[model samples]
Target: MQFIDFKKEHFSHNKEAGHYFIQISKDEVGYGDLEVLEKQDDDTYSKARYELVDDVSKVTIKMKNPGNIRVSF
Candidate 1:
């Protein structure tokens, strides 16, 4: 839910800016395996393995039947 909220607030801005990365993980802390979602020049989404830096925030995630996965700013 926190991630959804973050998306509602920030995703649009990032989309408009045209250069942003969305860090995806199996936990809020993002310490384990992770992925990065990015918008390409064709305005499509792409994902890849990535390791986030220390600045990302952690919050409880609530979603329907998820694998405890989360997306963060």
Candidate 2:
């Protein structure tokens, strides 16, 4: 039995410029992992960077399936 199941996990950040999103695997959500969803070259870049920080806050875990986990920062 599993507690969660998802076909894909997504991460995103919203800024004055636009919204950036990325699909991440469960294995990548760990300490010292540098996950880059998008990069912008403008004044909004800093804001976007800030928004991206701590994006994985709500994470769901599932049994049996290695990829059936969700992480929100």
Candidate 3:
């Protein structure tokens, strides 16, 4: 599922002119590959899979069937 919230200031609109926030979350128990993409000038995307960091944070805990994770962008 996808959720998009935005505000527009004109009758004729441009998507780039709005301020918005997006939230994407899986609604079921799942494990999948996550890919990061870079947008190109001609409206195409380049996919990139980054290496997962092992020790970015000092805090560590064990989670079983975890339902929530926080990511800051």
Candidate 4:
């Protein structure tokens, strides 16, 4: 529930700012996961496997369940 709360806050604040996509990358497997709190339009957001592009800092994620995401940047 805390994660959901955080996700909601992130979406509410960022959606207004036009941040439609959020990517999360980790160095190790099972570091963390993302979950959807709300949905706007037809976008789907959910926890997904990130494709490692470069280092741990760079990653590519597909928004399967469109919603807001909350992760430490």
Error of 3 at 50 (Å): 7.5
Candidate with maximal lDDT: 4
Query: What does candidate 4's lDDT look like per residue over 6-69, in tens digits?
Result: 3433322235534334444454223444333343346644444322233355433333333444
- TM for candidate 2 is 0.22
TM-scores of the models, in the order given = 0.26, 0.22, 0.27, 0.24
lDDT of 2 by residue, 1-73 (tens): 1122233243334355354444434454543333222223431211113122334542222222122222333
User: Model 3: per-residue lDDT, tens digit, 1-73?
Assistant: 2222212211122256342222233332123333334334575545422222223322221222221232222
Better of 3 and 4 by TM-score: 3
Work out candidate 4's RMSD over C-alphas: 8.3
lDDT of 1 by residue, 4-57 (tens): 223422321234534334433435444443333444457554553333444445
How would you order the candidates by lDDT, starting with the best? 4, 1, 2, 3
Clashing pairs in 3: none
Q: Which stretches of candidate 3 lie over 4 Å from their true place?
A: 1-23, 28-30, 48-73
Q: Is candidate 2 or candidate 4 better by TM-score?
A: 4
State, as a TM-score between 0 and 1, how close model 3 is to the true structure.
Answer: 0.27
By TM-score, the best candidate is 3
- lDDT-better candidate, 2 vs 3: 2
Tell me which of candidates 1 and 4 scores higher on lDDT. Answer: 4
